[model samples]
Target: MSNLPLTSNKLLSTLSSSDYERLLPHLETTDLPLGQTLYEPNQPLNYAYFPLNAVISLVNILEGGQMVDATMIGNEGMVGVPLVLGTMQIPMSAVTQIAGQALRIEASIFRSTLQGNGALYSLMLRYVQVLMGQIAQNLACIRLHSAQERCCYLLAMMQDRVGSPELIITQEALSRVVGVRRAGVNEIVNTLGRAGLIGHQRGKITILDRAGLEAAGCQCYRTLRAEYGRLSRP
Candidate 1:
């Protein structure tokens, strides 16, 4: 029997049984630790990862080493899209934003499978389109939203991805992921805590009131969720 766990990953789980079987032999379960670098800027990808509960951040570094988080991939998507789509090198760096497990497959095998002109290829193309939409939405959010609104949106999104109200992440790390300064992150966090919208400890946060958070966050979150729901549906 194949040892792969009953996958919670949206992409993999949505695959047709025949498509799943075709890819099964190449998949191996892997532990994705926090802060793990999956790929670096301009680096050749070796594998694609479908995260079950983990979240990966794609960061783009500026000339002076200022890094901005471009997008995030969780259970709904896979890493190494460029590899399967014909690009040999990835432009952004990918790192684990939260610790969890993923099913990984060799990039070569994945690419060969993509050439089969089957359901998997079509599905991956749709996923890539949805992922691009997320990136575009983030760009708009960053330009038009406040730090507090963005923070709430981010926390709310993480809650959905992790399937829990509570999350284990330090403020410093959160700041990096949100592309905000530590003081700004603290200010937003403090506001949320004071309002009882969320509970924050040293390195953990819990969503005490999802409704409150939804009200505080930007509309981009809802729009993004709707798009993902529409595009990623089986």
Candidate 2:
């Protein structure tokens, strides 16, 4: 297959023509399968990824083996922000939540591009603000929203990122993302399904009614979408 749609990433698509041409040769497409760790906390990041169709999950792993999701990076955002900030260490670990493609560049090379590339730097700055907003909104959503509402929001968000009704997630993983117990997640799942919002079996969940799912979710989903979707591109 041809390597088409390299600018499919919203962040990269905003690049100016000259900067894009200069950076093009250094970019490489890489496969990101489910559960693949892109970067771990306080570790060296080999590459920064600009997702094409994948959604990378950022999570905070507690000392006792518990994991809580921080935020997700889809085609609208790029990973490895810490590299541009003069650090390789971050508190959250980034892992692939949805299997798909991404454009990756070596961290060192990317930094070199920043040496006077105004557009890329400005874009990344805007991206950081977007990321911070997402994290804050998600924290509030988790604390204030009901489990069922949050479940609806999460499933809806995943559908948006994957651009398909099908979602590759188990109840266990979904529970982690929604910050709820597995049993609580099961109840939410049944509720949404009975309401004709979604369908699920094993490691897959499919959005059955997008409109209904949106109605079922909390306001945070809409907020995230507005901030991180169409308006997110620089």
Q: Write the per-residue lDDT of candidate 2 for residues 80-118, one digit (tens) a residue.
A: 999778777788899998888899999999888877687
lDDT of 1 by residue, 62-102 (tens): 99988888988888789999976898688889999988788
| Candidate 1 error regions (>4 Å) | 1-5
Flag regions of model 2 displaced more than 4 Å. Answer: 1-4, 229-234
Q: What is the C-alpha RMSD of each candidate to the true structure, in Å?
A: 2.4, 1.9
- The worst-scoring run of ten residues by lDDT in candidate 1 lies at 1-10
| TM-score of every candidate relative to the true structure | 0.94, 0.93
